[model samples]
Target: MTTILEAKHVNKSYTVHQHEEHQILKDINLLLKQGEFVTIMGPSGSGKSTLLYNISGMDQVSEGSVYFAGEKISALSEKKLSKLRLNKMGFIFQHSHLLKNLNLLDNVLLSAYLAKNSSKEVIGARALRLMKQMGVDGLASHNITQASGGQLQRISICRALINNPDILFGDEPTGALNSSTTAEIMDILHDINAAGTTILLVTHDVRVAARSQRVLFMLDGKLVAERNMGKYNKQQNIRAREAALSDWLTEQGF
Candidate 1:
């Protein structure tokens, strides 16, 4: 498999009050192969989200480097980085982050519009297709405030995939949903991964992590351990996978 994303000796720190420096990520190294699904799990403030941000270029690493599609992204100018993110990568956060002024379909089409890689007609058609695939096509004309949390999340997924990004970075994508809704979202994500989009998610839910092919455990700003569960098969027992992952996480002192 091809390596789509990599982090090498990455470190992230922030200056505190202009006097002290606090480290958020410590010497993190990782490689995400094409079409793989990986999850990061850790306690709050353990730097899992920080690592995601640094590796995705949403935040810059204070040291070392991040490479996307074999290019050194950490050294790129902000304009170039923005273009790369717009064209090559996708993001889904805990919140939908949809604009209040735009309808759901318009919101999903926003990034595609900015990318300008396709005509409005082409992007519109793709956006509608994504919305239908996510089961939110009926809500296309609705405002963000009109949808439930789960529905909004599905819309966000549509927005993320509008550009057909090579990789999808999710920060607690299902954190706010109920168990049933979380399962629905995870199923959609699993299908997306199966369709060949690499995914890296930061999550606290064991259910979410169990669905991933690999899970990374973080502690005190360091990557402490990793568990490979292999690819998910629909015929396999999900409960067993979740139990095994829970046991490993416990052993890691999570």
Candidate 2:
């Protein structure tokens, strides 16, 4: 498969009081292939979330570089990077973070409208299509307060895909959901990946990692280990896949 994203010797750090340097990510190198569904798993404070931000250009790297579509994104100007994110990348945080001022449909169309790459009619149609596919079209006219957590999350996913991003970066996208709701969101993600959008996510949930094609284990700001669990198939034995990943995660001391 083609390489959609790459991180070469990526490092991230911050300065605190008295100029003390605290490092969060260390010599992290990664490659995400086109159309691949991958996840990063680690304990809290292991820098998994930090890595996601740096690799996706949401945060600047202290050292090394990140590339998207063969361009060195870490070196790009913030203005260019923001434009790139708006055009080619999508993001989902732990919270929906939707704008309460705007109704659901308008919220989904917000970034696309900012891109101004298409007419309102075209973007509106695509936003509605994505909302319908995610099963939240009926909530379009409603404010965010009118929806459940799961419904809001689906709307967030629609918002993320509004511009047809090449890859979706998720930071624990299902962390706020109940068990059944998590399953439903994962199913939606599976369908989205099957439809050819690459997904890279960070999660503490074994079930979520089990559904991915590969899992990368992070520890103490390092890429400790990775396992190719193979592609997820709804027709396959999911429990068995989860068991296999659980055992591997155990060996990693996760």
Clashing pairs in 1: none
- Give a tens-digit lDDT track for model 2, residues 1-254: 89999999999998999699999999999999999999999999999999999999999999999999899999999999999999999999889999999999999999998999999999999999999998999999999999999999999999999999999999999999999999999999999899999999999999999999999999999999999988999999989999999999999987
Clashes of 1: 0
Q: Which regions of candidate 1 fall more than 4 Å away from where they truly are? A: none
Per residue, candidate 1 scores C-alpha lDDT tens digits across 1-254 of 89999999999999999989999999999999999999999999999889999999999999999999999999999999999999999999999999999999999999999999999999999999999999999999999999999999999999999999999999999999999999999999999999999999999999999999999999999998999999997889999999999999999987
Off by over 4 Å in 2: none
lDDT of each: 0.96, 0.96
lDDT score for residue 62 of model 1: 98
